[model samples]
Target: MLNKLSLLRNKIDLLDIKLLEILSKRLELVKKIGLIKNQYGLPIYVPEREKYIIDLKKKEAKKKGISPNFIEDIFHRVIKESYYYEKIKKFKKIKPDFTEILIISHDKKISYLFKNMLTITGYNIKYIKEKNLNINNINYLFKNIGMLILDISKNFFEKFIKKLFLLPKNCILIDLSPIKEISIKKILKIYKGPVLGLYYFFDYQKNFLFKESIIYCDGRKKKYYYWFLKQIEIWGLKIEYMSVIEHDQYVFFIESLKYFFTLIYSTFLIKKKISFNKVLTLFKPISYLNIFILKNFFLENPQLYINLITDSKNNIENIKKHLDYINNLSFVIDKKKKIKIINIFNKIKNLLIFNK
Candidate 1:
């Protein structure tokens, strides 16, 4: 077994060296071609040429017994990174002819954050206030904008939708999910694909990728994170469609509601002026576990505590559900009740594991 393992490692090492040499030669040739293309003032990227190369690579990958999907992803990132470097170097040489995206919002802080993210992701981002954008003549912006990031919470949804109807079918209209109710997803489906709001999350290796353009979330990074992002692009450079209302609805169940419950419990203790010592004395195990979760939320995403509670379309009534249940003790006193509680707890725990 040891001998076989050593032999396999040797084979892998040789393959790695061969791959590096091949890449070095390919890059040298690409640079030579780039020089010629530069002299002739040809485009930095030729989409047709790219398509042809991808087709050829797909055939080769099949012949080599490689997973085409895996090979394609590797090659796609290689090509994208190469071009990204070129774009940065010759930034002035290429400007997207189309407007790409136009953002109109009532909140300047949120607007600035969204625009900055787009700029980093290599887009020409533009913005206008809601009232000014509502004019009839400037509707041309909608015609060419491939994506729209609108703030419809401040009575802007109807007006934007009115103008957005003029845009072409392939042109996408996007809105960041608002904390308030903004149900434009169903309406925009007429001319757009999946919704792209400010927040998207995907598991990447052991870490996570988060984009908080909507509710003012922070940036996250991991090795596998970019791979996850690139995978999402197949569905129109985004993962899923969501309106501001839809976003809030989904987030509430997955995130906001849990945070709210925990925050309220933590806050209630603070307001009533209860000490950590009292909690440890009464419900040692439950109280200790709860505090661990509570402390992380209180300290890390501290802003989240503020944003979620103050959210415009927040289900204050649903939050009341947790509070209503809080005082209802006498849980599982009898042996039969204890058995039922344990069974229910185990089932819920098993369900969590399976879903994850």
Candidate 2:
């Protein structure tokens, strides 16, 4: 029996080697395709193509009497790796007509992620921590910098803007502040050069930039900054242009409101004195996703969420209105108005279904 088991294990190892060889050949084809996509300025991630491949594989797996879901899970991971390799081969370095690009950020991880991506694509990139910014270094650094990226905290924005005079008049400035109005306003007041506002929906922890969207607002000269935008596209990011007001409004709803809801839900769970471990065990698939989101929220810096919730007075007012809406529903529940609740739910359900 032991001899038979050993023989089976050897066969499995041989099959694994064959699988690796196949994957290598597949990656070579992916690399060639990536080059063509880059040459034609096409997007790296084609969702319809991915969906078709997954569906095709699942059907084949079913025909072979294998679990379709298991095959799907395997293909998803394989496709993700393919994307990674494709991007690595697809980067066409567009050397900016600048001496160097300087990235200033409070977060080291954020600074380094941009630096690495830019550097690999053959751009000269330098990083300076926000805390280390002083008049002397500002003078020396800005003298040769072709592009200045401000990813610093809002608290330092005013102070940092005061030093923009040191930057060359022709150098392009990019602000990565979440609050576009404030940063753009401050920077425009001080610097008359070409300015651009970018808010990245990036998860630096994962180190994957494929298909990530960046909210960009043109501050000064679009002609000067257009190349920079194209460079980011080549790196597999999607640029979404919006006005300053529109960007801020969308951020309030997308980020602030979502965080507020997560906070309220987590607070409710804590107030009920429920065991989190037990709750996890009892959660259905949807509930499990909710729990995962809640867990991820807490894993980040608490101060970041605090600032997000309190930054805008309008956001606070909106949160109050949300609470009032919830309170009204609670009152209806207390009064056992089942017909009213059902009517409201059905109206909302129909509206959502129609919209979808």
lDDT scores in order: 0.56, 0.83
Clash count, candidate 1: 2
What are the runs in model 2 whose C-alpha is more than 4 Å off?
Answer: 1-24, 37-42, 48-77, 135-137, 269-272, 277-299, 347-356
Which segments of candidate 1 are over 4 A away from where they belong? Answer: 1-98, 106-117, 128-143, 151-170, 178-182, 185-198, 202-249, 274-340
Tens-digit per-residue lDDT, 12-125, candidate 2:
999999999999999899988887876776667777899999999999999999999999999999998888777753367665455799999888665677788788777888
Model 2 TM:
0.81
Worst 10 residues of 2 by lDDT: 89-98
Write model 1 residue lDDT over 1-356, tens digit each, in one string: 99999999999999999998987777766776655554444445656777787788988999999988888888877775555333322212223454567787765644555565456545777877766653567666766666566654434555556565676554544445435353444444454443433554432121111221123211122221233233223111234545456667777766777787777788898899999776777876756767777767776646545655555445676667656655432444433577767787799999999999
